[model samples]
Target: MTLRKPPIPRLLLNNVSCMRNAQQILRHVNVSVHDGGALVLKGTNGSGKTTFLRMLAGFTRPSAGEILWNGHNITESGVFHQYKLHLNWLSLKDAIKEKFTVLDNVQWFEILEGKQGKSMAAIELMGLGRLAKEKARMLSMGQRKRLQLARLLAIDRPIWLLDEPSVALDDEGVKLLEYIIKEHRKKGGIVIVATHLPIEMEDPMVVRLPPRFPRRMTLVDMLDRSGLD
Candidate 1:
């Protein structure tokens, strides 16, 4: 009997740029990540950290350049859908159902459509086991954040896109998040985190975006500026 090695996944952003309301948000940004690697996106508010993740998630298209998932263009016909199968996204918004129990939220048999894995690891890792049967709405803000992150382990996806994952988490929760990331990376999974707060990752590739400021105006510029036709 022969065993086959797993495929090495790659995510590439070639000279990507994003625009909003006729203004540039991200300019000619480039990124590349493969199996077992991590990318940390750090920036101030409105600096486009979330925009970068959204672009990778296929929620929005880039204004220019290409997004390649395992050498296939994500925007190509039928590619985004396939790429989605590998994504485990943690957005700013929690996906918890207020009425669902904590354990049930991560183990939603009907609402979630995919292979369901054991949710106990995530429940124990996030310290939510004690509240397993409690309704999600009864949990506090930090608990909600932890519950939202528990989705990362529910499906065993290869790629994780975390947006501001540390927002409502405390020191212990943050540490647990890092530990989970390390274990995932060690298992050949890729992670991409967009956050204002610093996170600990093993030799992570960092992308820093600075706040965009409006073009400066001067008397000579005002005189030379052209009027709209």
Candidate 2:
């Protein structure tokens, strides 16, 4: 008898495109990432980085093309929820409850994800151990961001989709973020980050979205179309 290696997990974007109000934000984007890999999205403002991440999270439908997970079409299979379980997404918003304590917030996420126990280990990993009992509202913007990133450690997911992760982070905080990402990749995990700041990684795959011409839309209209209004 012979032993065989298990198949590696993968995420594929095939000619993916996104449109808002009849205007194209992203056009014919293609990418492929396997286990233990990293993909970086670099672009100027309004270049569809956020839109690409949102599409991967299934928050919005793409106007054209397909997104595949391990070679299966996620949208076509109607398994979005199941697909989500295998990945974690950190958007621009921290999504933290101000009333909850640092530790409580992490615990809440664990419970919501059907996971048990607290995430003290993750809390410490993010350098929030001393503030574990402090209310989320008391923490600084950078601390709150660290707390959000800590949730990734609590949940064992194979894929990570991050948007502007380094925003508001200090030099030390940025270093910590880099360490976490590298460690995650070493453990056979996949990471995709969209950021304006630089992130140090070993030969990461890069995708650059071309800048789009600004459309004549009000601030309110843009917010509404982005589902943020």
Reference-based lDDT, each prediction: 0.86, 0.87
Supply candidate 1's per-residue lDDT for 10.
94
Q: Residue 164, candidate 2: how far off, in angstroms?
A: 0.4
The candidate scoring highest on TM-score is 2
**Against the true structure, candidate 1 has what lDDT?**
0.86
Best by lDDT: 2
Tens-place lDDT per residue, model 1, 1-229, is 9999766449988999998667788889888888899999898888888888898998889999999998889998699889998898998888789998998988883246555556767787789989999998999999999888776787678899999999889999999999989999999999999999988999999999888676679777777776423
Candidate 2: lDDT of 52?
A: 79
Model 2 weakest lDDT span, ten residues long: 73-82
**Residue 26 in candidate 2, Cα distance off native in Å:** 2.0
Model 2 score (lDDT): 0.87
Q: Which regions in candidate 2 have their CA more than 4 angstroms from the true location?
A: 1-9, 215-229
Model 2 vs. true fold: TM: 0.87
Per-model TM-score on C-alpha atoms: 0.86, 0.87
User: Candidate 2, residues 90-199: lDDT per residue as tens digits?
Assistant: 98888899999999999888888898654898899889999999999999999999998888788768899999999988999899999999999999899999987899
